[model samples]
Target: MVKEIERAGLPVVHICTVVPISLTVGANRIVPAIAIPYPLGNPELPREEEKALRRRLVEKALRALETPVDGQHVFED
Candidate 1:
């Protein structure tokens, strides 16, 4: 639905582990997620570390949303 949202003149940032799929779906702004099962957090990590990771991911996503893109763009660390 990223394309659909953009079609309506709204920007969307797709956060997913699969970058290719996000591109195929026509997501203009993409953020690489940590993992498939835990896209936003790592349960194997300590609570604080996981939180920090999640925060950074979210910040990147927000940055992606704010940035302008002519086509599919993947925001990577």
Candidate 2:
């Protein structure tokens, strides 16, 4: 779907736990996530901490969307 969106002339940032899968799917902008079950949050952590983590991930994704890429790129912390 990421490729399809990009093909439509829209940029997409794919947030997933597996970087390889995102690459295989031709995601130009990729953001590494925490886990499969909880990609943006850690339930074991305190509520505030989890929220912070999710916020950071979202921030990174937004940054990825802003940045230009000639090809596949991974936005890592």
Candidate 3:
């Protein structure tokens, strides 16, 4: 799906918590998030904390849209 989306000439940014797994599966571009169970939000965490984490990761993913690269890339903080 990632490749197909990119092949269609659209900018693709894959947000994943388990970054290595996504990369192993051939993700063209990936942004590291929190964790696998909760890529954007962790249920055990307080709502505010989860929201903050999600917001931060989301911002990074969005910035990735403006980043141009020639191949698979990983964004980390």
Candidate 4:
């Protein structure tokens, strides 16, 4: 789906726990999730802490969209 969207000329970021899979699928903009069970949130953390983590993940995704790249790229903290 990310590939199809990018093929349409719109930038896309793939947020997933598996970075290798996203790269193999040809996602140019990639953001790593905390884990598979809780992709955006960590249940072990407090509510506020989980929210902060989610925010960081989204911010990275937005940053990935603005970056220019020739192939797959993964955004890091």
Clashes of each: 0, 0, 0, 0
Write down the lDDT that model 1 would get: 0.93
Q: TM-scores across all candidates?
A: 0.95, 0.97, 0.84, 0.94
Residue 73 accuracy (lDDT) in model 1: 91
As for TM-score, the candidate ahead, 2 or 3, is 2
lDDT of 3 at 7: 86
Q: Model 4, stretches more than 4 Å misplaced?
A: none
Range of the 10 consecutive residues with the lowest summed lDDT in candidate 4: 68-77
lDDT string for model 4 (1-77, tens) is 88999999998989999999999988988999989999999999999999999999999899888889888788888
Backbone clash total, candidate 3: 0
Write out the backbone clash pairs for model 3.
Answer: none
TM match of model 1 to true structure? 0.95
Candidate 1 minimal-lDDT segment of 10 residues:
64-73
Q: If both were scored by lDDT, which would come out higher, candidate 1 or candidate 4?
A: 1
lDDT of 4: 0.91
Span of ten consecutive residues with least summed lDDT in model 2: 68-77
In the range 1-77, model 1's lDDT, one tens digit per residue, is 98999999999999999989999989999999989999999999999999999999999999998888898899998
Tens digits of per-residue lDDT, candidate 3, 1-70, equal 7767888988889997777777887777799876777778889889998898889988888888888887
Q: List candidate 2 stretches off by more than 4 Å.
A: none
Ranking by TM-score: 2, 1, 4, 3
Error of 4 at 12 (Å): 0.3
lDDT of 2 at 61: 99
Candidates in descending lDDT order: 2, 1, 4, 3
